[model samples]
Target: MKITALETLRTDEFANVLWVRVHTDAGVIGLGETFYGAGAVEAHIHDTLAMRLLGRNPLHIEAIHREMLNLPMAQSSTGVEHRAASAIDIALWDVFGKICGQPVHQMLGGLCRDKQRIYNTCAGYRYVRSNNIKPVSNWNLEGNEGPYEDLVGFMTRADGVAESLLESGISAMKIWPFDPAAQENQGLYISAEQMKKAIEPFEKIRKAVGDRMEIMVEFHSLWNLPAAMQIARALEPYKPTWYEDPIRMNSPQALAEYAASTNVWVCASETLGTRYAYKEYLDRGAAHVVMADLCWTGGLTEGRKIAAMAETYHRPFAPHDCIGPVGFIAAIHASFSQPNTLIQESVRAFYTGWYNELVTTMPVIKDGYVYPMEGPGLGVELLPAVFERTDLTVRRSSL
Candidate 1:
């Protein structure tokens, strides 16, 4: 079916999320979402991408994906251009799945497995709720919303948080206690005191759950290479499952050095855009586990390619989903479709909290494993309340 209109929606409440709806001539609409910098992504889709997308065949996903990347600015980075293109690409796939009367995972190549293991990203209810994307400011750690205020739990009572996750059958949890030190020192160096304090959570987790809970230490690309290596050396004793984005993703050689220095797997990044950038990391043996945020890394189209490339290097793919509901669903589809998908990244805070408020359906996440989603397309839709919300702002570009 021909793409008739491209509609984008954003709400003042969810400032960092932008939702795109691809309206087709056959009256089937496909939904896609991208997180962070909603304003810029929205502007790119309507002001720039609308010209390339309108009246085109929505099912010709590869052609449209290539046309979307034709701009010089859209090359190999998870910037605004990639984010906008990613949303549209996901929407196009959604259209294809709906037209074929199959789920997006089936459209990608069907399920490799019936379920995938998941790791809980320990973020609080209101984490990254504001426009500020920085560490301390973006945390939104003001109030105790409910039982799963995990960001606070991990910081103050990590032992308790680990026990809680274990109780829920979640064997893996990702935490970033070193971010404060990175923010304070501008990622240059960590003092002895800072190092001691940052190591507390790991100590607590080990004391509480021992090896039962797999710990993924997230550095959030905040530290310099030397400092990152220092931190990695210190945490080696704890036997963390992985070190995620310990340093910036720009230098493959530097990252390879960091990886060579440590025994723990180095999960490269969700910041990278496409397989072209991932190839650099794989070629250099920098990243042991490949991570991509489907929403920003060109959606499922590029996401599957990245997964395959990682597979070639004997690496495992883990899809990132600390974003919006639609993007999370898309990641699940990618996770199940790829044969070498190691695990899925999820936030207990987001999934159990605000995610349900915006989406009509979500994957059945039970006992730390996410079961395959049912129905056509991404198997989820924006809730009716989201459309009717008073804070919502909708924009459209029609043929």
Candidate 2:
């Protein structure tokens, strides 16, 4: 079916999310989403990508993905160009799955397993709610919100949070208590006091759950190599499951050095765009576990390729999902399709909270494992209410 129109939607309430809809001549519409820099991504979709996408075959996912990334600025980075292309690529895949009457994982070459394991990414209901994605400001710790105000829970009562997660059958949780300190010192150095304070959550979790709960530490790429190495050394005693983006992902050699120094697996980046960048890390033995945010890293098309490359290195793939519902669903499809996928990332807060308000369906996440989506395409759709919301902004480009 020929692509007829490209539509983008954003709401003031969810400032960092942009939803894309690909309409085809055959009357099937595919939904996709990308998170962060919503404005720029939206502009790119309508202003730039539409020219390459409109009137083309919606099922030509690879061709369109290449054409969209033809711009020099779109290469090897999760910037606006890639984010916009990613959304469209996901939408194109959705169209393909719908046309084939199969789920996206099947379209990607069928499932490798029945269910994929998951870990809770400890973020609050309103974390990163606004466009201000800086460390402290983006925390959005103003109110209690609900039971899973997990960002606060991890900071103040990590031991309790661990127990709560275990009660829900979630054995692993990701936390980033070091971000505030990193922002304060500009990632140059961390004082002994800062170091001790940052280790408190790990200490508490160990005290409460012992080895029952796996702890994943997220550094948000906010530390220098020396400081990151120091932090990794300090946490080696705690035996964290992995250290994510401990330092900037730009330097493969530097990241390799950091990985060599720590016994903890270094999960290198959701920030990277494609397999080319991941090849650098995998080639150097820098990343033990590979993580990619499907929405930002070129959707299912590039995401699956990255997963395969990681498999070649004997590294496990873990899809990131601290973003929107559609991206989360897409990640699940990628997770189940890849044979070497280790686990899927879930934000209990998002899936249980505002995510319900936006989407009509979500994957069955039970007992820390995400079951495969059964419906055709991504197996989810934007709720009718999202379109009817007062804060909604819709833009369209057509053939």
Candidate 3:
């Protein structure tokens, strides 16, 4: 079926997530999502990518994907142009799955596992919704069930947080207690006292849950090489499942050095754009677990390739999903289909909070593992209520 229309729908309520709908002449519409920078992504899709997509066969996903990236700007950077293409690529894949009457994961390869293990990235209901990422004080505009409920626990009551997650059958949880300190020190260095304070959460988790829980330390790519090495060595005793984005993502050499120095597995960056960027890291053994945010690092198309690269290097893959629901579903498809996928990153806040508000369905989480989403084409949709929002912006370009 020929592609007929491309539409971008966005709502500012949840960190400005942008949704794309690819419509075909056969009356099938596929949904896709990308988080952050809704305005810029919308412009790139409608004003630039629209002409290349309309009237083409929606089933020719790779050709259309390459056609969009053919723009000189898209090849050079993973900025707005590639982000727009990533959303469209996901939509096209969704359309392909619908046309074939199968789920996206089945199309990706077939299920490698019945259920994928998941790790909760412990974030507050409003963590990613704000602009200032650190200080934790910026999140004070909202209050959770208690101080231990949200971002506060990572700083004060990490043991309680660990206990809470374990009660829910989630054995692994990720926290970023070090990020605030990294922000304060400009990622250049941290005082001995600050380093000790950052270790408190892992210490508490170890004390409270013992070896029953797996904690992943998320550095958020906020530290320099020297600082990251020091922090990694300090946390070695806690035996976290992994250390996430300890240093910046752009340089493979620095990340390799950091990874080599630590016994902890360095779960490399989601901030990297595509498979090419990841190939460099995998080639250099820069990470032990390869992390890909389908929303940020191209969609399932590139995420699958990254997973393959990780497999070639004998590294496990974990799909990052701290953003919105659709991208989370997309990640689920890739995670279940890839044999190398070790785990998937999820957010308790988003999955239980705003994610339910906008989407028609969510993944089935049982005893800390997620089963493949059923139905077809990512197996989820934006609820009509999202369109009814007064703050929503809708734009469409037709063939």
TM per prediction: 0.99, 0.99, 0.96
lDDT of each: 0.93, 0.92, 0.85
The pairs that clash in candidate 1 are none
lDDT of 3: 0.85
* Model 3 spans with C-alpha error above 4 angstroms: 131-141, 145-148
lDDT of 2 by residue, 1-399 (tens): 699999999999999999999999999999989999998999888888888788999888888889998887888999998898889889988999999899999999999999989999999999999999887899899987789999999999999999999998999999999998999999999999999999999999999999999999999999999999999999999999999998888999999999999899999889998899999999999999999998998888999999998988999999998989999999999999999999999998999899999999878988889899999999889999999999999999999
Supply the TM-score for candidate 2: 0.99
Which stretch of 10 consecutive residues in model 2 shows the poorest summed lDDT?
Answer: 44-53
Per-candidate alpha-carbon RMSD to the true structure = 0.8, 0.8, 1.7
User: Residue 269: error of model 3 in Å?
Assistant: 1.6
Shift of residue 276 alpha carbon in model 1, Å: 0.4
Model 1, which residues run further than 4 Å from truth? none
Q: How close is candidate 1 to the true structure, as a TM-score?
A: 0.99
lDDT of 3 by residue, 182-201 (tens): 87888999998998888888
TM-score, cand. 3 vs. native:
0.96
Which of the two candidates, 2 or 3, achieves a greater lDDT against the reference? 2
